[model samples]
Target: MATFAEPLRPNVASADVQLPGVRDYEQVDTEIIGTLKPTAGWFGALGVAIAMFLVGAAAWIYQIYWGLGNAGYAPPVMWGVYIITFVFWVGIGHAGTLISAILFLFRAGFRTTIYRCAEAMTVFAVMTAGLFPIIHIGRPWKFFWLIPYPNWRLIWPNFKSPLVWDVFAISTYLTVSSTFLYVGLIPDIAVLRDRETNPLRKRILAILSLGWRNSEPEWRHFMKMYLFLAAFSTPLVLSVHSVVSFDFAMALTPGWHATIFPPYFVAGAIFSGIGMVFTIIIPIRKFFKLQHYVTINHLDAAAKLALFTSMVVGCAYLIEFWVAWYSGVAAEQDYFWNRVFGEWWWAAWIMLTCNMIFPLSLFSQKLRRNPTWLFILSIFINIGMWFERFVIIVPSLSHEFEPWQWGHYVPSWVDMSILVGSFGWFFMWFLLFIKQLPVVAIAEVKEIVPPKLRSHARGHGLDPSGHHLPYGTETPGEFD
Candidate 1:
């Protein structure tokens, strides 16, 4: 709830030697590592997050004892909140890959300010998402049966089924994302190791650092491995979401079957993911007094990204409707009509407003740069995207096939509790992470700070002299 106090470097010249957010290069570590030490407010937020997770855990326990009857599922609409949320969280995980991998490959410098936290979100978002399928299954104890494994009976899991793909895709995604996050942290961890005065903390940091000495040979190998992993991760980000879309598009059910789904879902995933990053990083910058590090310029770039993706998604919506009209498919036409005019019509309208209408506000540079507006719009996008998934899943199921078989589904308390809990679990992990590790990558960010700034600051006695600095210093270079 705290606000940014430092004036944003909006008109900063292109030729400025030092990056806008940083002054002396050596101060990057001190600025970032301070976040590892928590305040009372962080503890308070952590408590709330833990409480939310516990609420969901209690609901799951109750459901386990009472069976699926404890949930909202019934008749034609057997899938409800869990499936919607699964899609939501999975979509939320996409932006991290977009920022950390795709943008890195393209050589974007802005990513340095935000990629660490974004990557953390990707890992935790997937962890939250991986839960729903298990929770949705009537017998979670047998969820492992979904996995392909050697057996004496010689019966393998269904390779043709997208359900099986979900199992493999999500597990593989979590593994790669976790590795990406830890790999990025190694250099920062070594920084922590060197700074620590306590013996026990140093030992833990040493184990985590794997003897990283930041030597030239080590730096060469690290960059190669990091880029190799990024290349490997690039396709997985695309494929994992495409496979998720297949879960629906591969089905022939009314609104579910379509060629547009793969791209639509991917765009929606990135759009929602970017929105969430805004929702997160805004508070982080404000509360942690990181305005200098995460400037309005950084936020503006992200807002532009969210706006572009939102328009792409908005076009996808129009295309689906146009295709339905042009194709003359009765089921598809009925599904679209029902979505707009039938039961849960409110949801359809809400989704359109959130995903299509609200994002249009970002077209104004004034609104995009306004932190308050950006935060509100980001929350709206997240909510709208969630209902977009709900509208897609539920209406189709509610009106499928024979009128006699059709039935409506309503969310039970269990559904609401688990939904709230999943959010809690996610933030809980994120808060703990920020408390224990540098929220931004100190090394990557330092690469952008002009060495001249440090020299100039030293000349003015604004910072300590170069030789006395402990974080290692680089000599200043003249402009080309």
Candidate 2:
């Protein structure tokens, strides 16, 4: 609403940033809220997502019925694709919080157009990631045992296990991030509520909006709450993935046992997360015709960040080999050597090329700005990152202490089906979300658009729409 608009202010690099072309608050609402109206394509995509998820659900049901043996869990390589995907999805969950919470803290304007989708991606990715642990345990029903509750039998989870650490880290991150997302959505939801014609939908929106009236007091409290959540969620950008990295760092396995795991994993998580964001947003931008709001400049900024993280990840890769060779430890050196030149050499090379080499193309401004090129590269990044996890987990576990213990791990159809299903499960939720809510934040985007004077602001405490303008007392010159 016009009442929610802040005072006119100059946006940074006003020339370069592609601010939305809308001239008034009403246009912003029309353009954004208008996207919620779904079409045939929306239903078609939703159908595909549901189909994929059902196929995966079938695979999971079969796995549960037959047992974990149906999976690709060979002797030495007990971890297999389940564990690899668990880590990958966890890493994928990082970018949303980083883009939303960390960027907000730094006052990055580019994030305003993109953070809402990224935040949703974070929540859904985590929900997807949470499934793996239960699946890996081969017992979905007993997952509650991981919780530290007062059980009559006094049985408890091992606190030292990194899996336990993941439980706490992921659950905490999910709670805070979702709450942060919902809070930010309140005002925008209020906007939808005020504009809705249907009574049924209006009632639902009202309840979700918590009776928001767009009052000065509400805006004041909202700003304060958002700021606090931004600050609170920032540390999680680094900590959550760092805790995930501990799954490997704290392990005695040669490839996994390195102090660099925390920062390295953190960097890779952000990189992969950004890649997923690009993958999801690019299609949405095209189909939804939201080019003005989610512009090339926003993609370019995201590309640059992805490129930066790629470089960090590249350095971490080299440092891994350097550590292995420099330490002169036979087992560690052998493990590193076997990783690149061993049975799973193809997987290793894919990791190297996708995660490290391919991203280098982003250094070129042309490639970074081109949406098509960026989308392709994002696909490569996601593939490479998944293989990166595979390389870390399977290789280390397969070729361990004794040559007799070494084994080749190949994923069964069931394992592959579930992996395919995870993507389905994630996209299903995301597709439903876009149709149900505003993908772009109406209030934040308005903040970037330069303000204007309304007739009601002329010595009257109201805008043209009869909504109370917070800055109506100020003269037109003050806005300038």
Candidate 3:
């Protein structure tokens, strides 16, 4: 997601060199660390999230008492709102990994500012997504049975099941993303450890920092480990979501049988996740006064990314329908046609309008750069993407062959409460994260910027990628 940047200048020397946006090294630390303090607004937001979380808890309890019937789960549509919500959150989780690991591997330097919070979102979103499976399983206490482990009873998971693959895929993704976020934060934590005076707080940060010393050896090892982790985790972005898609693709259901499922799901996941990223960062950037850090340029870059992924998803939608009709498969054709013209036709059109038509607005530079427009459109994209999963899951199931067994699923209050609560769970974790930690990566931002900026300096003028920067010219629409 490279933004428009000016052409590079070659005359700058070591101490005078700086990234185009930043001011100085000392100020970078102050600005980033300053974000951790809790304000009244922060607490107010947290309170709402906590309240919603409680509502969800109560809903779960009621569901337990009433059994799965409370969610309107039925035979043909056995996978109801719970499975749909699971896939939605899983898609939302994809943006963090995409922006953090994949963009890093691709060397998109602009990602440094947004990656920290985005990575944190990945961990929390995955946690939220993971819960749906447990919730979907009627026996919550027996959720542990999904794990394949050696035991006295000798029970094991179904090795061939996509559900089993999800356990591994999501667990692996969470572990890697958490480690990546923490590893990237060690230096910043050490900085906070030094900045704070309290004995208890300093000690905990010191432990978490693993004794970072700003030494060449420490940096050398850190870079090595970071690179290795980024490379290793990159493929999981595609694999994890592909496995989730397999939960549908492996089914014999007409709409679920495409070989295109893997890439299609991956594209939609990135699209929804990028939409979510904008939804969070735009306000945070303004409220936290991080304008210089998460610049309009950065937002422009992200909007472009959202547009790109939306197009990919839109193409996948078209291809799915075309293939269904082209194959002359009665069941597949019927399932797709019912989606656009039958009982669930409304959901299909909503998905197409939101995911495909609305995203084209970003092609206008004015709209992409306008924060208010960006925010509103992002919200719509999120809603549209969610409906995409709904239409995909429901229509096929509701209009399956032998209309006698066909049925429509409507979520009960319990289902809606839990669904809303999942969002609260995600936001609550993020709010706690913002209050306790630097929302941006201090060290990575400093890497491209020079140690001193107001003086005539020597060497180190080149970027981390070894390109000499344009010192004075301010050009737009170009990037490394």
Candidate 4:
């Protein structure tokens, strides 16, 4: 077992010039020391989160006891706030997957710190999102009826039904995401287990670490497994969000039946999800004094990604209107018009302004670099994205083809309480995660900012990779 100060040098390089890629494997020990210290701000955040969780839990219990009728979901508005928030939270989950999986596959080096927190967010957000459909079910107890089970009942979920598709898609996504998050945490947990002298903490971490011993072979296999998991997660993000979009597109409702729904939904998901990443990360970084690691660079990268996705969402909005007008479908045209000038016109405009126009400011380098502005912009994007979901779900169902069936939908108190509670629920889980695990990837960061390597390479006038033999491999003491 190597100590934190014992640096592992490449055989070819001198001891003083630290090589990149896991030089100080024991740095994890120092990192865990800070992570275990309880802070006032963390406890404050946790307190609020717990309160919110309790409120949400009580609301859910009420729903279970009193039934779905309490939620203001009548015939015309079968899907209300629960379904809308479900889609909203699920969309917010996309950015994490995109950041962690897609960017990793592309070798985006900046993702190292960003990916861990975002990936953890993805898992918890999905878990909270998955609860909506189950709670929305009128008979919550019979939720398993949607599954294909071999039993005396001899029944199967309808494969053709979009709702059933959502069940399968979201379930599969949650499973994969949770597995990915847990796999990534295993080595980090082992680091904690090795460092902790406390019996309780050591026992807990030992169980979670799964007998991991930081051997070269273990690290090699873990890296390969991580790469494989990343590959698997990339497609899952795309497919899960697309399937959610299909839930609406497959419907015959005028506004719902559009070819553009898939891409539009996915882009909006990324946009909102990235907004959430900033929403959570900015505060966490500031509170924990992790600015050195989280850095302005990470913020800039996330801002750029959010800006691009917002533009993509904006384009989707334009294309949707064009398609509605050009397709010669009367109902579709009416639906489009209703969105802009009808009862919920304000919502459509809010969505456009907040999600599209506001985030566009990030196009400026100044705005992207400004943390305060970036945080505000992210909050706006989140609000707008939520409104976007509300607009899509409600207005379409509210003002359908049949004038006789047309009705306005308003969320009842139970719905509002639960919606608010979900935010608390999400934060509760996230707060726990930050406390219990390494919020930043300790080993990965050490890999990125290897000490003495850059100075040595530069002194020898060698490239960053340090592959130029005599030119790159300086005597370590000279650089140190």
Model 2 spans with C-alpha error above 4 angstroms: 1-20, 454-480
lDDT per residue as tens, model 2, 1-480: 356657232222222343534456777899999899999999999999999998889999999999999998989888988888988998888999999988887776678889999999999998999899899899899999889899899988999888788889999998998898899899999999999999999999999999998899999988998888888888876888999899889988889899999999999999999999999999998998888788776787788899999999999999999999999988899999999997788999999999889999987767877899999999999999999999999999988878898888999999999998999999999999999999998999888655655565463444576544443323221111
- Order the candidates by lDDT, highest first — what do you get? 2, 1, 3, 4
The superposed Cα distance between candidate 3 and the true structure at residue 61, in angstroms, equals 1.4
Residues 1-480, model 3: lDDT tens digits: 889665242222112223565656677888888888889999999999999998998999988888988888877888878899999998888999988989888777668788887898888999899999999997788988888888998888997999899999999998888888888888989899989888999999999889998899999998999888988888998999999999999988889988999999999999999888888888898889887777666777778889999999999999999999899999899888888988888899999999999999998877877888989998999899899999878887777778688887888899999998998999999999987889988888888565543333344554443444455444332222
What TM-score do all the candidates reach, one by one? 0.91, 0.91, 0.92, 0.89
Pairs of residues at least 3 apart in sequence or in different chains that clash in candidate 2: none
What is candidate 1's lDDT per residue for 1-480, written digit by digit as tens? 999775333322122223444666567888888778889999999999999999999999999999998899988888899999999999999999889999888776668788999999999999999999999996889999988889899989989999999889999999999999999999999999999888999999999999999999999999999899889888999998899999999988888899999899999999999989998999998898888777766776778889899999999988988998888988788888898888879999999999999999988877977899999998999999999999999999998767787789899999999999999999999999998888888888877764543564545323444422222223221111
TM-score, candidate 2, is 0.91
Candidate 4 per-residue C-alpha lDDT over 314-358 given as tens digits, one digit per residue, 9 for 90 to 100: 999989899999999888898899999988999999999998899
| TM-score of candidate 4 to 2 decimals | 0.89
Candidate 1: where are CA atoms >4 Å away?
A: 1-18, 452-480
Q: Against the correct fold, how does model 1 do in TM-score?
A: 0.91
Comparing 1 and 3 by TM-score, which wins?
3
Worst 10 residues of 1 by lDDT: 471-480
Candidate 1: give the clashing pairs: none
